[model samples]
Target: MESQELEFHTAEEDAGLRLDVWLTEKLSDVTRSFVQKLIEDKHVLVDGSAVKSGFKLKKGMTVRVRIPEPVSAELKPQDIPLDVVYEDADIIVINKQKDMVVHPAAGNWDGTLVNALLNHCGDSLSDINGVIRPGIVHRIDKDTSGLLVVAKNNAAHLRLSDMLKRHEIVRTYEAIVDGVIREESGRIDAPIGRHPTNRLKMAVTFRNAKEAITHYTVVRRYPSHTWVRLKLETGRTHQIRVHMAYIGHPVTGDPLYGKKCSLMDTGGQVLHARFLEFMHPTTGQFMHFEAPLPDYFTRLVDLLESRSSGG
Candidate 1:
């Protein structure tokens, strides 16, 4: 497959930013993890020389990235059923299940939400995100089940992208954290970036970080766990998980940022994208959809509540 090349020149305002972070923001469709992969494979260059993902940018430096075509050209449609919340000519809101990768990446090249959308929506999905991520507007973690909207066309894709950037979209999530948060409600305003050493995980760090805010209200308190509802002010990679872990209450069963001695295991994290609110990209009408807590999540909550009450 032929690769595509894109170039960027660092401006005064871009100086001091990490290469992977800057390139990810510029690409818009790809993730920082993918960008870092490109850097590792020598597909990224600064002033025509390969550089590390964390290379600090200097004003006037020219950065070039080579985007390789997806592994498979003819992506097949899988006959997987989607728990669709809402569907229209322009968008599809899905209550994605846990263990389902949102898009194909690296080890996950099939059996993704995109493949399923290909089967359900067929040729109606948007191609603005290229071949791999057609119709995908945003993504939650594979282990994090939730509601996400997919665009069916280019016009819808553009408008929805704009709405996301402007924070016009509202995404509310419910998570079981490993602590009893005494406060009824609180806000976490911190910058999230790649962990200094882990590289695979995100952390609340000022270095090469982006602004992330999460507002959470304690729904219920257990002896060892707390149920909380959280809303995102900005969507950064693993923002909610990182912020929660930073505040000493990682989401229960989260393999990456969770506590080792978890109260219970629910296959993955006990987080669900429960509510989504946004304006219809094409219709100019208000739109809102909800996905109730998945059975697994509710079952865990029930067990936790029962245990807290000595049941």
Candidate 2:
């Protein structure tokens, strides 16, 4: 179980607004479902009195919330190796390797980023992500290699998550696609949600999907493949892969979305998260970090250059 106390001071303009809406704006990181649960459980109070989601806010009223401890699964910390690129009291930037799962789930309980982080940070990490994912602010897929920023405390987690929502945190990726892309640069703005029949996969669903945007630039091209740099305008699950596949240029060796290729004999698609930039959660300083291309990506580049030169 966990205990938390939150205070919200209402503004004049926010007076008479529903309590749920007020809390949503104040605690932007926690989803509405979570906030509503707090309210329903009588954990949320207006001026020391329990209230419902529809409770009206008063100009000078303060909303206090006390969340009870959550029942979470057991997750033991392991001494897994980590490539820590940056670290401070509030956050850590890791150059995560390919094939390492970012968090624990079914069948992946021990060898995860959370396990490694627990070993690294000891008891200093926050429990905002529950017992399993103590201080995780965001995530990158297991097969995607490169820089990822993790929070160290609840304050830092909330700050970094807010920055992400505001698009202040920037991430860039380099991908090798299966087909030649003629365009020098372009943007793909579409909606993404769970696949209709396949619930495990995400697709560009026309309805009930959230807005997703990706910008791409052709870096180099071979006879049958193209190297591209991608910038995210919105972060959706499997966004880059799904957006590329939607445009008919899925990443090479993308077993889930693209044709299988042995260009560099890599196990997965030739995609890498190359760079990340964001404001520090506590210090408010601008931080930028980059990860060098893995061997397979570099080898693919060499092959492209050699073919371009008729080698």
Q: Which model scores highest in TM-score? A: 1
Query: Relative to the true structure, how large is the alpha-carbon lDDT of every model?
Result: 0.87, 0.81
Stretches of candidate 2 exceeding 4 Å from the true structure: 1-73
TM-scores for all candidates?
0.77, 0.75
**In candidate 2, how many Å is residue 93 off?**
0.1
- lDDT tens digits, residue span 1-311, model 2: 34655566676877778888667545422445667888998988888898889988779887777766654558888898999999988888999887777887543556788889988999878777778778877787777788889888889998888998998899999999988899999999999998775444689988779999999999888888999999998999889989999999998877556655755666567889999999888888889999999887888788878877889
Question: What is the Å distance of residue 15 in model 2 from its true position?
Answer: 66
> How close is each model in CA RMSD to the real structure?
10.5, 16.5
- Most lDDT-accurate candidate: 1
Q: Positional deviation of 200 in candidate 2, in angstroms?
A: 1.5
Off by over 4 Å in 1: 1-73, 260-263
Q: Which whole-number lDDT from 0 to 100 does residue 239 have in model 1?
A: 88
